[model samples]
Target: MYIIQDKRFYVCLVVACAAVFAAIILIPNWNRLERGHGASPRVLTIGPDFTRKSLAGHLVLVEGVAPHEGIEDIVSGRGTHREIALSGNLALGYRTDETWLKVEMERADFRRRNLFLWMQPSVLDHVRVYLVERHGLDAPRITEIGQIGDNDPDYLWNGVGSYLILEYKEPVSQYYDLYFNIGSTSSILLSGHIGTVEQFNNRMYASDLTVGFYISFLMTVSFIFVVLFFRSFSKNALYFALFSFMYAVNIMIPARMYELLPVAVDMNVMDIVNVQSLILLHIAGALFFRQYFELWITNEGLNSLSLWLCAMLLAMAIGAGLGGWQAIMPIELGVVAIALWLYFFEYVRQFLSGRKLSRAGLLGTGLYSVEVSTYHLILIGAVAPDGPSLSIIYLANALFILLFTLGLIEEAAVQERRNRLSLNLRLARRAEQTAVRLAREMTRELEEAKVAAEKALETERRAQAEQLRFVDVISHQLLTPVAVIKSSVASLRRSVGEAGGDDAMRLQRIETAVRRLRETIDVSLVRSRISSVGGRARKRKVVLVTELQKIVERSCRLFPSRDVTLEFDNLDLSARANIDVEMLGIAIGNLIDNALKFSDREEPVAVTVSRDGDELSIAVRDRGIGVPVDEIPKVKERYYRGSNAASYFGTGLGLDIVNQVALAHGGRLEVENAPVGGLVARLAIVGEFDPG
Candidate 1:
């Protein structure tokens, strides 16, 4: 159940590791203690023309003397130096006091070539080389000599390897005696090989190439890890970047890389730096393994210890970088030993718990731990002579790292799968709840919509019935007036004919007025019903001008005192329409009635009729207060009137009726405010209403 989400676990892991590291540093070991020096020379024989085998194990024992015995006095054979019988290929151990080595090399063809001696200690601080010619084992004569050290102003050699030389001639000298004085701040490990010029040069070049390649490889790997860390925020990549950087630096110092540079470096500084870098490498490696294995949560105690070690190592490293005392390299080594032991312990715990992943990881890491242990012991000269070689340690590390990389990949895959499963379960629960809620909402909304639709249909049915009843009432009221007008017009026409020609025109006007009145009443009554009931106005050929003339006379007779003007245009062009002459007339009469109703009796009402192409239009204007600007848009709505017209004695259905009539006759009604004063209403009967 443990996951990367537990951040507190990681914090504790770091603190515990750092504290343990600090404790580790409190104990010093082999790095601070000094070793005894060699006192006598070990002699050697070399072949001619630079042909001598490597001295990997041959130069084990040699004569060694203390620092106070000067080279001049020693060559005079006065010092009481002793023979040092070294057991291995190199001298190992830390020593602050200077020690001298004496070697006598004789060759068959000494006159023909120069002899080269290659001594590499990697950490030596200073060295003095003196080559003396021995004539019949008599008092030695100084023929050639040189000195080099970490503090020397000039690098006598082109590379980091410490080399000395001796020369001989058949006449002057055939045998050479060599003396070298060496000392270092950290350790005085000495290893050497003697050969002619050709052999020494070949081996030195090869050594440089190998070291250079190794350092470059480590740097490249470190750079790659740093870039990976930045790209993905991968924790493993970050720790590995630290590990690779430290590993590179540790190797560089031991290889005497500082000697090859243009600047001189104090061996003391390099000594501390090497120790610190090594400790940091172990710390980074520990952190990487902890996270990579999921041990930070499962093995809480182990995680805490690892983190404590990391913090302490970091503190020690910073101090070393800033020139803190560094005589306690062995303490750091001791910490490294403890960390490695913890790594094994954690792996074993995981293994015992039946974790296959941990078990597989243990197989690789166990090999890795063995190699690390061997390396540390070798550094302090604790490893037996027949034990694993340095080359085997490097090989084991490369293989174990590859195996660890595989294990990390497997672990990541497992974690990712678990996360996806958790996410899917969460989404499923949300979807189930949303589905149930949406079903309920949809059902409720459908029921609400159905009830609303039924109510709307019932209201519409009642409104249609009311409109039919209203039309019937209006038709009944207009019938009696129509009949009375017809009767009166007939009586007047007959009387005028009998009385003579003088009353003939006036009688004809009476008849025309009566006919127009009947037409308007019929149109208004029939057109008020809904158009969908198949109700339509009766159409006839009616002259628009003649109808306008009749309406003006009727208005004059009805109002008696009000002045109404009739304007006719395009009359000569036969301005006629096959409209319900009565419906068209009613629409025009409604406009005039509205005009007269809203205006003062003193103001003249204008009724205008015109024609253009197949269209007939009647325009009426009144010099009264115009329709209010705010009410103009909705003035055509049924039972709607302007605020100004509210006190007038009339229903507000006139314009609405006219609007329906115009639509039934294939025309439109337009209302506007007159330019000079009152309101103008125009009824445009368009689209060939002319009767054949």
Candidate 2:
């Protein structure tokens, strides 16, 4: 089957080529031979005959006559009639008595010839005419006007309607005009000059304008497709392509509109469309090349490029508005081309350095190269060569573009599939490594933590043993003082009843010493009571402020009242905290007592309770010699004291013990100088408190 089909393909190809050759050979050569041009110039024997209504939809024709006769008559010093008479020479040798309508001048002397050869009567059947005068424009004047009778080929308006007008024709003057009339339809002298009506009819109505529009539109759509298909490509290229295509289209707009509808032609519209497109073309080219190259120099290169392009575009628009079309096009195209070339050079360098030329790039680059090549060819056609077939070149370029683009898409899909498989494989390997490493680290961390915890437990056990031994030694040392006091108390009691005056005095002294010793023991017991309460940790609760306040009041009464005063600043009532009330109170009490001991009698110490967010603060500020700046940090350490305060009567343990109590209750003591020239011992408890 495959062999048979392959053989049939070659057979079909041969048949197709044969068919095309045969058709080409059979076609007539009338157009190629210029046979249509001299066919008697198709004279109008009489008038075109049709009503205006019947001619509404029919195509009319009018011929343009150059006023060559008028000029020739003047150069010969002949009158306008001399030019009118020269019409005989103007008549191409035809054996017809039917004279097509001819133009004669009324302003100049009608001595020799008619300067203008008017439109043929049959021209009204297929074309519309606008008369061209030598100088000043005027409406068409009536000469000989009538309709042809039916069945008369020599004078009939074949397609539609007809009208004739013979305006004043001046010789050697730039002040004559022409008119066009179809049945009742007619237009007078136009404001602008008519160059060549034949050229206008041939070129303006040509499909080239539409073809240009479609080319621009197709390029724009193709660029957009490129952007979508090649996601890896930068968005800037897509944008540039879009803008360039749009700019090109914009440039062709005026010509397109004029060709499609000649009624709306004007200088302003032409200027705007032409100038804007030129400016846009350059801007698009610059940006497209810049993005395509990835030529980022500065940190904000893209931003800078965008700004510059926008500014240039704006400047060009302004220039076009002020300078008009003639000045704008050259300037815009030149600047744009220069800027783009620079950008393209930079881009090429960058692209060559890092870009891995993929199948897509190959396709894109190939299409672009072809496009550039054809553009140059088009330039050649416009300048050096006159007969190059632009359509064939464009068609080839389009076909290559479409085919390569489709191939690029297919290549990208295959690449994406490979990437997905590779990515999945890498993920699997990474997952395996992660699982193994995580398990090993976790096991090592767990073993290390177990060993550290055991070491911590042993250390704590030793510390407890040391503490118990110290307590035992303290108890033993305390026993001797107790025994001595007991013996002295007994001797004093015995002597009180039996001795004389001297003996009584000794007894009284002994009794006084015993009583002081008893008081010392009781004070020690009170210290132990405070310590016990401080040491018993419990889950914290609200009412930290109230407990702090109570401690302040009690401590103030128990301390020396001579010079120091304890002033309790009210707390914020809304505050609350979680703490052991007893522990908190003892902590605050220790702080207050320490403050009063260090404070001078003349200035009252201030006890303030305040709350900030979720934390509570109690400040026991003393108007006394402040803690030395260097010793402030050490004051919170156990059994540590400020050098200045160490010489005072109180034990150095007061602040140390206070700190422990504070920590046990989830708080801390910070000692700093008060703004009022004293030490401010602030206890920060991390809980809500009502400082009211």
Candidate 3:
């Protein structure tokens, strides 16, 4: 089914092209048939009421060499003159030979009126008309009526064109012969009309209106395209604008628009301009289609070929301008024909391959191909029509422009739609990617949350275990002191019946045991307070020496027999510091207590307070058993008891509490063995102290 459809498309294309070719050949022949072939001479009778008459079938044409005596030699039959009846305009292609046309006219009545002879395509190189009055053939009197050439200053121009016109002022003879001598480097086409003054004026008015409108339309379209090109920078618009403008100029040159200029331009130069405009028109057309069809993408070969053809046309135009090569016209027409066919063929091939081609482009190209080829065929004398009619060519061009403009609009819309669809597709893909990324991120976050929850649960379990162990340690420490107190009290009661010395000793033992129990409770309370407050400290200004003196006095009273001595070196008794007083006092007392508990009763534990620079130091030195060197670092850890502390009734939190207090004050606790014996624990506080 698809094969059949494809074959049908090809068949339609072939049939359409064949029909156009057939019309191009048949139409001109049909026109020629309607205007009968000029085989016999027909005399035109000019009555007083005659307005106009075409000299087509009423003329006899003869081709010969230029005579030195001019029309006299032709009239006297001095040379061989082969004359034939001309059926239409003289289309003797590109001839330099002289051609003479004879028109026979007879006056019917004596109502004399001025008569005019008009000739078209005024680019003819030379033209001379002679009026011959035959008085019964007794040596016919020949008088030159008018002479005009392309370069002649006497050339006549009407508002319509640079066409040749000759005026006859007086009509004396009843029978007259009008002889036309014409020659050209370009195509020899002489279409003439004879009419009265009113008739000539009327024809001129109509021709002016038609030609004026055609030129105006072309210029207007060219200006519009020029504006569009600047606005959009579109190559299609630019080339089409050039094509329209050149075509307008091409038409105007033949219509004798140059005659309206202030400076009289030589017709030969205008002829060069005419040929150059045609060349430019073809070049612009090639470039316009190259862009319009997007041939650069669809077919690079055709694109390059179009550019090459344009370059050749440009060279030919330059040559025509420099040397006036009238032969370039036919060559230019041939190039345009080839370019049009190539473009059309490529478009059709692309269409059949299912590439989206513009329907308007196809129609425009088809119509243009037919009309332009027909026109070229007529210009080259391949058809019966001698030349293209102005009206037909102008209408064909206008329709082609309309169709091409429609094609441009259609292509623009299609491009816009494609761009929109592509943008939507890209957006959809981006959205899909974002969704996938979000899903992956969510999965990662959920995994991380699960791990964090597990870590929190494990930490809580370990904290609970530590709390239970702490409670057990506190209970064991309290029970030891309670047991000692119970034993000492029972011994005191038993010693009541003994001597006074024994009873005093037992009371002293009970007193020491009670103090130990109170100390243990105080240590637990300080630990709880420190834990609750964390790293925060409430500081106030106080005299450091005075605060240290109170701590020393309390320690002395607690261990009276241990001889805890308070000492200082260069002590500033009135110096004040911003410190937490109670915390500092507790830390200092813990150092003294630990010294007393770890050493012998007669060890003389010394407490020294001093200041150096910004640092305040309270050192407690004991002269007894010191800490093991290896276990020194671990002694300041909470609830950490040393191996040497087995025989002592002490909680392991004293040094740790002192360290915490030192850190809270932005200071440090230093513990080391004294040089003599035992350990020296220094509570160093660094702060701004006022000395008085």
- Maximum-lDDT candidate: 3
Candidate scoring better on lDDT of 1 and 2: 1
| lDDT of candidate 1 over 462-489, digit per residue (tens) | 6866775676687778789878877887
Which pairs in model 3 have colliding backbones? none
Report the error of model 2 at residue 684, Å: 5.4
Q: How high is the CA lDDT of each candidate model?
A: 0.64, 0.47, 0.73
Show the lowest summed lDDT stretch of 10 residues, model 2. Answer: 184-193
- Writing each residue's lDDT as its tens digit, candidate 2 over 79-108 gives 533212110111111111112222221232
Which candidate leads in TM-score? 3
- Relative to the true structure, candidate 3 reaches a TM of 0.56
Q: What TM-score would each prediction reach against the true structure? A: 0.54, 0.31, 0.56
- lDDT assessment of candidate 1: 0.64
